[model samples]
Target chain A: MKNIFYITILIFIISSCKKDGAVTNPSSVDQTYTPTPYFIQYPFYWSYYPVPIPTNNPLTVEGIALGRKLFYDPILSQNNTMSCATCHNISFGFTDNGKQFSNGLHGEIGKRNAMPIFNLGWYEKYGEINHRFFWDGGVPDIESQVFGPITNPIEMNENLFNVVSKLKSNPEYPSLFKKAFGKDTITSQLLAFAIAQFERTIISYGSKYDKGILSNFANFTQEEKDGMSIYTDIYKGDCWHCHTISSHFFTDFGFHNNGIQQTFSDSGLARITRDPADMGKFKTPSLRNLVFTAPYMHDGRFKTLEEVVEFYNSQAYLGANKDPFITSDKHEAGLNLSDYEKKSLVTFLKTLSDSSFINNPQFSKQ
Target chain B: MIAIKKSWYILMGFCLVILLYSVSCKKDSTNATPAPNPTPSSQKYSLSINITHFFGDSLFKYNTKFINAANDTIKFNKLAYYFSNLKLTKDDGSVYAPETYFLINFDNSSTAIFQIDNIPQGTYNKFSFFVGVDSLHNHSLAQTGALDPGYGMFWSWNVGYIFNRLKGNFGAANTALTLDVGGDANLMKYDLPTSIVLTSNKVVNLKMDIKEYFQNPYAYSLKTDDSSIHDLSAPGISKLVQNSKDMFSVTSVQ
Candidate 1:
């Protein structure tokens, strides 16, 4: 009886200790801890860049933290007054605060409006005609693209060499660089890589519209759903040709001549490709965050989404080089939607405004 | 007696588990079942290519002197060129090609960071690569990555990617020269498909010398006559025609 009592006590101690003890034995409940946040997790399917990703620059928590800090640091600019966040504000769906153009160092006004960055990783291509980046589409690839604002007198106003030297001067950045990359020294290439990694994480895939399409969602209002129907109609209000809406990234990744202005001094694709026929063409930006990214068009000519719709309705005047898609009609006659249809479209566009992206502490100015 | 029997059973079970574990560990350490041994001496090797520039007999150092049109002396502050589409040919006549491969912006770091993985270890007889944009990336809005815009390699106004950007200043004349060449006027207008082929075959141990290019004076000369600047900001008809003509060359196997 005494032996039995001792055996019972031993078994009790062993089983109770297991609540906090480390054991290799398989259990009914999951013991392994895997905590990937809602924002940073990879999509179900994704593609990589053309020039394959260096194994060293694989995305990681430390790399992203360093990148976020670099992105917000004004030290990237010459005068140390402006950063990428100056133009790409977090509150305004990663765009300037509905401004026509953003102000740079020494208060220099840019010619083109700042573009809202979202789901950049999913884009097979960027810029007009699926070019790399920029309103004029001058730079190719993200690595060289960062050099633009850094070197531009009107933008960052920092010399490329000077910028490198400044980054090296920062005691914090070196450690961050070492954490992200093995080495502590920061190169423009490495800096760009880190920034790209952070930007790639800025996915707007959790919008009501996203959920609607993904889960056959009914979270949105009846008007918003009606607007989406009009927006998706291929022949009618077919905005999908350029602003594609798939279950994943919500863009067709194409350029279009959306007849907004008569004479494009900007000469977007014309500036990049040097083809006369491509005159007045601009990249078709995604309409995912249109509600927050106001002051529409490349030059920020339109103050509101209504004005943008009106311009598209009028099919604003463009000359012989104009795209055949934009008919000569004053407005896109094909739309032929009632006032209610227009209201529904606006409501649906609003559903794309995700509060989570704005309020997420992770992306905020930490 | 029953207690003794129960203790013996537990001890036996524990001993059996420990014995299985030890056997498993030993199996892992030694090649327990040596099945299908890998072929020995089937060699695989790697070769690196370093691209260098030359002006005549000597290396083409950046910020060095060169004569342009009208006998104007000029020196380059920055002299870099783009080369892409590397193809490696082995002695067996097998070719290994890197897809969508290109190299630009001559940094002190790695060059043409493409890997010719799984190449059967053999002596490569020849190395080849295109010196300019391939027909694919040259397509309208049909590119990404290093092929994206704002590299200052594109003519925004003219709607064409500048195939090359050769910038420098004439020292004697105190004039600056900016030469951006890449586009076919024939393609822009009548779609005649006027494209030039600039390819080179260099023996690869581990480096590609562009020195042969600067050695030939007539092949690439700086012009400082009227607009020595030669800035093709926009790919206008004149700019397109002039730049396309100036920025290209072909070299033979070394």
Candidate 2:
């Protein structure tokens, strides 16, 4: 009789416990978590430029924290193996360290070269079409563009619905989502918004280039100074036309054909617009953090800055859709840069690398 | 021998569960179903938008041959676009904005039907909606459903949405034309003025005929003419987009 009674009690106990643990819902009153606004402070020197903070997604402490976690979480990947940081390493100015192409889930290589994410908050509309993010200029906003890699077949290869379902199932993510977005429920919009908020806070103002060139706080070396002259002066390098050194971001943020090919393997902007005239046109990447991010260009063709400079000096093949400004009065293969001039230009590019920005703790994975 | 298996242990387990539940799952305020002054349990308004494709009153069957301005015989692979910020207008001049965004893709039968639920049953006169996302949601990050950039409708480089995308085969094998339109955020928006009386039947069948893209006020004849076919995009784009003004209409009010 005692054993029968015990079995009945055990049955009741297990049955009652099963339903109790299943409730994941947060009631109406607990849904409200106050978001503390985190203001992004800009350097006084860059006041002239517009910060690309979206009016809808202002930065918050909780949001930035959640974004940081998500940015580093491999849970965003299809196989739960790759995170955004897998390619965009914080040590390498948020670019893949010396990788020609980033590795994705199941050993799939990325389609394009990984871009460095720094001072993206200040990247703005330049020239005719105001394009931002990616070499092809496919998506417009940084937040919206976050969908690119996660769903990209060669990248993370995970869908937004799956990402949501996965994040919702995790015990910790729901509360993190609540702290950032004011509810326990998770959504893709909030995921992108939080990640973007964290990315915007990756400010790179403490570079030696900033102090030595822009602020005149540190003295520039003679080689660095001479290189800076070639970089800025229209007669020598003529690079200032596209990558203007006058701006704090050091990029005009315009798309260019850049005299790279004779026959197009990559249609570049043409693929996006379906306009044949846009063949070989690509967004001009920011020249900052060259020390860490190697194998340059949309395809990461050059292994070093010397190779990139040397290619532009003579080996550049201006295809059918080369930009007009890449040539002066006469059509030439390249800039025909003198050997000394090329070295100086390369030296100047190295000064833009910000070690302080890469080492900052706020950007580090905790 | 275990002496009734100590029911107090089960009681202790229950206490521990309650403690953990209190910490993680807040029911004091959050889980409470805000039942203050609950409304009458009336069934909600069932609003559904049905997309019907046509090639000038002839039903648009996919894979059917059609000639383009570029003189190429073409058949559609897919047609997808966004419909955002749909609002039902009442007689009081107020609007009931839906929390949903619709992406109508004819290739997927599921996408062609958009059923909206939990809407308040009322007498709505007219509905206001946009064919593309506005500037606010367009540039914002990681929007789901219709606005998700993963749908291949977003422009990442320039930060805009490709309001409408048309993909199909061209004249010869291996030749194709992808006409992406509607980044002109200033010009792409269209407002529908059709009257929708939502009194007797909560269901409204909104029909979007693809052939209407060719003409309503503007004839997109440039897209069909063979002589103008050499030009890839410039021939009849403006004509087609301008014709978008008459795309959506109230086909049924039941």
Candidate 3:
């Protein structure tokens, strides 16, 4: 009887002590686990500026692979019918295939054109300000821009909470997330980080322009040579003002009202900024991949390079917020390029097309 | 042998009683109020702030009708805001700044109360916090916790946090009204006078009067003023932000 009593007392004491110790000891997160880092290779001309990989979310091979899988997965949509690739197809320079505006779920037509995706990592900054994303230049970074399409009512039309839950329940995704983010706990922030990492890798630098620069015009035809001269000539094409080619990315990454419309129907940047002075202003898109990314401008008004060149030649609306470069003393009315000059300019613009980037199997929906 | 056995039984009984008493004491300590006696300054305690919302003199309830200072009948569908960078001023002029960010939504009862732990025992007289995120974190990359974009407080298209959002309907026609106030320039800081004697664990009760947001320094009339305000440069946004700075007040400290 005495032994039984003592044993009971000892067991009670030991259990209580153990419970108290468990409660007091702080729970720890494993901080030693570090994933393998993946470095991006840039063209030699782009070395002047450092790549803006966020310190908190460094790129990894596992992360980029997981991001690629998520980009192609239809589970992110409401009815599991649409994915990022629905609008951003790889064959079309990561843009909707010859469509003016992308079609969303429920056959809803979007108000703006789907911008192409390429060389986004180099768009880290413009002048002193951090680079903005989307046609309106509203979002500050690519990571933040990921949330827009997924939650947009006309786009994916799905809740972020639902997407997280769906990803968590997937058998293959949990392990993939664990390998990339160090834990299986899926979060919207990590989702954005992964997608942004993959987007930063879809670079386009193997075009004829790039090759010609390296070889000092050895590969250029006579027509392409004259086209290049007219493209860079200050008094002729004058396209270098906003669509700067010297930077090699072929864009100044600035917002300007290029006189696309006379009346403020969509109100472009003014819708986000709420300033009338910024009325009708849209982001200056890069001039690369002109062959694949057709139906140009913010609203995708022009269908072909001939139409785009003709619009700039004679149909500039000359609105109040029209960029001074278009209304400058050199060509106040328009570029007024002749038929031969227009055809040559079109041929030269095609030199910016990189077939290797469009056909890269790594960017496909594997 | 009998006497030794009796003494052993007494000692064992005494130890069992001590064990039970100590366990009960540990449980009671968590539920108890602030200790009356002064504790050592080296010891740390947690400070909890319970936020109770109000509309004028009554407790604020969502989807309920209430008359505003403008005499317009209003019914709120949503009310959410962020509290960030909580700082406490000690009696010696020193500041105890806790890196805290909380997204308080009227629909979520769990987010109504937040605790600031690991605070050194001291007499604090002032409390200050920002109604919006700092410019550094606002424009920075993706974030988690309360600042996460998943919370719906963030403006993903514009790349900023909507500091405060009050969506509702008003008037005879039941017109929709959305007031999403956000911007780096409009981050309002409130420095409220407080008398908190923190010897042990303490809970400070704060009352947020929703009616004060429409009145106080600026009298906002839903009938006359622009009912929808999503842009940062909207006409009455500065007035609304100025009015919101005076909404929170410490009702009691325990």
TM-score of each: 0.62, 0.69, 0.87
User: lDDT tens string, model 2, A247-353?
Assistant: 75777877789878678788787766677888899988888888888879999989999998877667767557787767555437566677888888898888888
Candidate 2 stretches with Cα past 4 Å from truth are A1-32, A125-130, A214-218, A274-277, A318-321, A330-337, B1-100, B103-141, B144-203, B206-251
B170-231: candidate 2 lDDT, tens digit per residue:
56563565666655533355455556655434556666666666556754443353213222
**Runs off by more than 4 Å, candidate 3:** A1-31, A127-131, B1-39
Instruction: Please identify model 1 stretches exceeding 4 Å from their true place.
Output: A1-39, A42-56, A125-132, A136-144, A210-222, A233-236, A246-250, A318-325, A328-340, B1-175, B180-254
Indicate the residue-level lDDT of A126 in model 2: 48
Candidate 3 local lDDT, B132-202, one digit each (tens): 89888887437889988778887767778988889999999999999899988889798889988888899
iRMSD in angstroms, per model:
10.3, 10.6, 6.5
What is the descending TM-score order?
3, 2, 1
Complex DockQ per candidate? 0.09, 0.21, 0.25
Return the lDDT, model 1, position B70.
Answer: 34
- The per-candidate TM-score of the B chain, in the order shown, comes to 0.54, 0.69, 0.82
Fraction of native Cα contacts reproduced by each candidate? 0.04, 0.48, 0.51
lDDT of 3: 0.85
Backbone clashes for every candidate come to 35, 22, 0
> Which stretch of 10 consecutive residues in model 1 chain A shows the poorest summed lDDT?
A45-54
Question: lDDT tens digits, residues B1-254, model 1?
Answer: 99998788777755755564455445343544676664532444443444444443445556777553335565766554455666656656776666634446654433433334444454454555554566556533223455544344544323345654556676556577665555533221111111112122222322333332222233234441223423344323243333333223223213
Q: Report the TM-score of the second chain of model 2 against its true counterpart.
A: 0.69
Candidate ordering by DockQ (highest first): 3, 2, 1
Q: Candidates 1 and 3: which is better by TM-score?
A: 3
